[model samples]
Target: MTSPLSVIILAAGKGTRMQSAKPKVLQTLAGKSLLAHVLDTCNQLTVDETIIVHGFGGDQVKSEITNQYTQSSFTWVAQTEQLGTGHAVKVTLSDLPKSGKSLILYGDVPLVSCQTLAALKAANTDGMSMLTLTVDNPFGLGRIKRDQNGNIEAIVEQKDASADEQNIREINSGIYCVDNALLHKYLPELSNNNAQQEYYLTDIVKMAVADGITIVAIEPEHTFEIEGVNNRQQLASLERTWQRKVVADLQEAGVQFADPTRVDIRGSLSAGQDVFIDVNVVFEGDCTLGDNVYIEAGCVIKNAQIGNACYIKPYCVIDRADIGAGVDIGPFAHLRPDTVLSDNSKVGNFVEIKKSTIGQGSKVNHLSYIGDATVGTGVNVGAGVITCNYDGVNKSQTIIGDNAFIGSNASLVAPVTIGDTATIAAGSVITKDVDSSALAFGRARQVQKNDFQRPTKK
Candidate 1:
């Protein structure tokens, strides 16, 4: 039988270089905290227990993680002193089960894939394994030292390395997978005798080598998987790298983009075949686009479902809306929450819809505000139309029946209904209900005067 796995995430750093009050792991990349990314990745693995070691901003870290992951179980360990990485893991030892294997991870290195971690865990056949990388410049990093027979020996930190050891190209990624029994045995024996006078987790490599254990080194498929964020610059760089990967995956799934670099997806975005997304578009909070849907530049869509063949013009904001097939919306329109557009409906420029249902074949073709209303099928709402659905304190609903024609600059006061085939004259404000096939003119007629004297300019 396979032993269970435990994951230990180190997230105690203050990240002084980042110049922020929040903890380093609380810093955001791709609209999520750095630690959130790591926790999300750990959720994909078969982890028996998750232990997080926190130092600075411990309460904030615990609160955030607890609130975000209410369903997942986690053990929070506080490191009172900021000794080193070795000490960080040492704090989590009390919560770790001693029979299975444990995987050590860093919260700031948020892009590590689950596949790489699983491979690292599987490589721990002889109780010890670690992730390593070979780079062009290994300066200021811990170098992996090997014996004369090319067998793994130890890890030499940059400050303690000799001149010959400093030139090694392979560096330690500081990620390790070890047997829980060995961790309990070796972690307590670690000493702060290095040049930095702090316990180094890499020192365990030497201890394993002395006991005749072969240390397996596994490298991730991408270098960015091991990248750590220390400052805002590195955070931004990783953000772009992550976004590039997201765009690449979408492209592979047959989504077309005008300029992939100009788009930002803060949350989940799913697109069907033949979807064309233009530049500077932002998608947030679970948006879905069907086949042949065309989205123009500078549109923000959030938590909305757009049906097949829908055309969204430039600078539109759609939130929590369900749009039917063949619907056309704005060059500059706002469809707020609870708005539904039926098939073949058209919402033209500078229109705003809120809590309303526009029926099939209906056209609201100009500047208008339709809120708390139901517009019937084949209805035509002219320019500058307004549904007066609010009365300072309470909101009411306006219902327009089938084939209703509302003229330009008209206001239909709510708690009213316009019947089937009804016509509302231009610039009229109807406060009462109009019967079927009736013509409602709320404007007063012009009165003629026989003679009037004109006043001269002062």
Candidate 2:
């Protein structure tokens, strides 16, 4: 049987270079914290236990992670000192089991793919395995040294390396999969006699070599997968890199974009075939677009489902709404939570609908606010119309039946109903219910003022 896997994520570094009050692992990338991404990757693997070593902002990190991943089990170990990488892993040794393999991961390196990790784990059949990368400029990184016969040797850090060792291009990625027994054996013997005078995790390579244990090396599919964030500049660079990969994957699945670089997806966005998305469109928190859906520029859609052939004009903000087929929404419309639009419904510019249902073939065109209302089929809500649903202490509903006509500048007060084929006159304020096939006018009658003289200016 394959051995069980335990993951130890080192997040103890106090990132002074980042210049933020939050911990280094808590820095965000692509709308998620860096440590959150690492935890997400660990979820992809069949890990028996997850151990996180936190130093600075440990309480905040633990709280956030526990809240976010309530179902997953975690072992939080406190590393009170800012020690080297070896010391970080040393703190987690007591929590690990004795029989399985331990995979060491870094919280700041958020994008390491699960496939690469699985490969490294598979390579740890008898001894240890690590992930390495070949770069053109290997300065300030740990160089992977080899013997004359090309056998695996020790990893030399930049400060402790000779001129020839410093010239080596292959660098250690700091991700390792080591046997749990071997980790307990070698970690205790690590010495801090090097230039930095800290326990170097890379020194384990030399210990394993002396014991004649084979060390396997593997590389990731992309260079960005192992990139670690140190400052805001690196964080932004990796953000763009991650977004490009997301867009590339979406493009492969036949989604069209006017300009892929301009769009930002903060969460998962699933699009069907022939879907066209314009520039500056931001999708957040689980959005889906049906086939042939056209989204114009400068729209923010969050937690919404749009049906097929829907045309969404520019600058619309849709949140927690469901739009039916062939619906057209505005250049400046706001569809708040619990709003639903049926098939062929039209919502024009500057309209705001909250917790309302617009029936099929209904049109609410221009400067309207419909809240806590049910608008029936074939109904026409004219310009500048609003439903007075809230009255300081309570909220009420407005029901408009089939073929109802609400004229311009009309206000339907709470708990009111406009029956089928009913007509509400312009500029009227209807407080009571209107019967079916009836016309209601609640405005005051205009009287001539010819006899009254205009007031003189004081």
Candidate 3:
């Protein structure tokens, strides 16, 4: 039988190099905190208990985790001092169970896969196991040393390494799996005599060797999985790497991207078959695009549910909107929150829709502002139309019945209605309801002024 697994995540560093007040682990990647991404990978291993050792900005970390994961079964352990990695784990020893294995992870390293963790856990079934990687540049990293027989020996920190030792490419990843009982037994033996004058966890490797225990060293297939972020540059590099993986997966699922490098998915995006996305498009929050949907370049869509066969032209910004099938939207349209467009609706250039609903087969074409309104089916809202739904203090509604036709430059004041099949003449400012089948005219009548216009150049 396998022992139960527990996890300890180290997130105590102040991250001064990041030049921000937030803790290093709280830095964001792919719309979630870096610590959140590590926790997500940990969740896949089904560990019995998990602990986070937080120091600088610990309160903010606690509050954020509580808000984002209300149901998470994780315990918080405070490392009050800024100490080394070994000390961080030592502070959490009291919270760990005695009868299981403990996996040590770093919050800043978010790309480590669950499969690699499972392999580490399996290897630690007998004794200690550490994840190690070999890279071309090992500058600022700890080097791994082995004996002539190719057996594990000890880890040498970069500052303390000799000229020959500095040439070694294999480096320690700072991730480990150990028997819980042995971990508690050896943590007290760590010494703070290294160059940094901090208690180093690598010393435990020497203790394991002295006790005749074999330490298993496991290497990940990709070195990027073990990369850690310390500054803005590294954070951006990792973000791009993660994005490339996302784009590859989407491509495998039959989603077409005109230029995959120019697309960004900051949140969850789900698309059906035959979906096309152009360059420089950003999909944020939770978005679902149905089959045959087409999104043009430079569009930013957030929290939208777009139905099948809809075509969204370039430079549109949509947020919290629901659009139905066969809809055609603009090259420069903005759909704000609570807006809904029914099936076969058309919203054209430079139009903005806010907190409104447009019924089936309706068209709001060219330079219109529709807000706090309900427009019925088969209506034609002409160019430069505005729904005057606000009066400084409060907002009102403008309801247009089925088959209504609103002419160009019309301003329909709110708390007003236009009955079915009604027509409002061009340049009208409608302030009252119009009866069905009526042609309402509100502008001043045109008059010839040839005899009265001699007051020009004074």
Candidate 4:
């Protein structure tokens, strides 16, 4: 029978360098909290259960994490005094079954992948295994002290190491895979006789060494994958690292980007063939761009589904809108929820479409507002047009039939409609419907009075 695997994540530290009241693990990296990334990878390891150790800002971290993943069955272990890493793990071990393997991780180091963890698990023995990395400069990190034959050795802290021990390039990465029973049996015996008076989990290797237990060390391919964050600089560095990875993934999946570094995708994006996304674009909450779509710079799209051959010009704010193929939306267009544009539609600059449907081959050009309106095919709605679909109390609808020509500066007050092939004169206020193939002129006639002149005072 295969032994079950459980992951223990140490995330209780309050990062003072971060300069925030939030816990260290709660700091966002790559649009997700550090602990969230750790737990996501842990799930891929087939981990039966996840146990988190919380200390500083324990209540805030617990409350936020619990709220974020309400359905997850994770155990919380509280070490009230920030005793140390060893004591943190000890607080959570009482809940474990004491038979399977326990993999220890740090939440601030959020980039660990499932492949690396699987490799470490495959290399684990009956004793204990440590994830080790060799660097050019092993300055402040703890050194891995090996034996004469180099079979097995102990992990020595930086402060406790002698001058000779400090020269070792191989450093322990603070991650381990160990048998649960052996780990629990030896963890309680760890002492705090050091200068800091804190229990170090690294000392467990020495205890295992004294008992003639074999220890294996595995190095991760990328050293940055294990770099833990204690400050803002490290957090920013890792943020760039993760963002590059995201960009690479999307590019590989055939998404064309004008500038890879300038795009930010906070949620899932589905792009069809020949979709062009310009710089400074942000897409969130499951956006889909169909084939031959062109999206300009400074666009923020959320929860939208755009169809093929559409042109979304610069600085457009789109959310919860569904668009059909061959649509053109503007340099400054705002598409609010439930707005649907059918094929061959044109919504030009400074136009706002909300809760409306624009039919095929319809054009609503510059400086127009269409709300709660249904516009038909082959319709031309000119500049400075307003639907006037609101009476300051409730919104109403204005429906237009096919081939209608609405002139410039026209105000179509709802609830009203214009029949097929109807024409409205420019600068008209249309309050009533016009019959098919007719003209409707609602503007009063302009009359110039010759005697209408201002008199000068005597």
Writing each residue's lDDT as its tens digit, candidate 3 over 1-458 gives 66889999998888999999999999998888999988989988878998999999999999998799887878899999866888889998888888789989999998899999999888874569999988899898899999898767899999999999999999999999988888898888788998999888888888888888888889986677899999999999998998898888888988999998899998889899999999999988899999999999999999999999999999999999999999999989999999999999999999999999999999999999999999999999999999999999999999999999999999999989999999999899999999988999899979887768666786
TM-scores for candidates 1 onward, in order: 0.90, 0.94, 0.88, 0.83
Q: Per-residue lDDT of 1-458 in model 2, one digit per residue for the tens?
A: 87999999999888999999999999888778999989988899999999999999999999999999999989999999876999999988888788799999999999999999999999987679999999999999999998987767999999999999999999999999999998899888888998998999998989999999889999999999889999899999999999999999899989999999999988788988999999999998889999999999999999999999999999999999999999999989999999999999999999999999999999999999999999999999999999999999999999999999999999999899999999999999999999999999999999887789888999
lDDT (Cα, tens digit) per residue for candidate 1, span 184-203 = 98999999998899989999
What's the lDDT of the predicted structure labeled candidate 4? 0.88
Choose 1 or 3, whichever is better by TM-score.
1
Candidate-wise lDDT, in order = 0.94, 0.94, 0.92, 0.88
Angstrom error at residue 332, model 1: 1.7
- All predictions: root-mean-square deviation over Cα? 2.6, 2.0, 2.9, 3.7
Candidate 2 global CA lDDT score: 0.94
Off by over 4 Å in 3: 1-4, 44-48, 147-153, 211-214, 393-395, 415-419, 430-448, 452-457
Clashes of each: 0, 0, 0, 0
Query: Which predicted model would earn the best TM-score?
Result: 2
- Measure candidate 2: CA RMSD: 2.0
lDDT tens readout by residue for model 4, 360-436: 99999889999999989999999998999889899999998998999999999999998999998899999998898
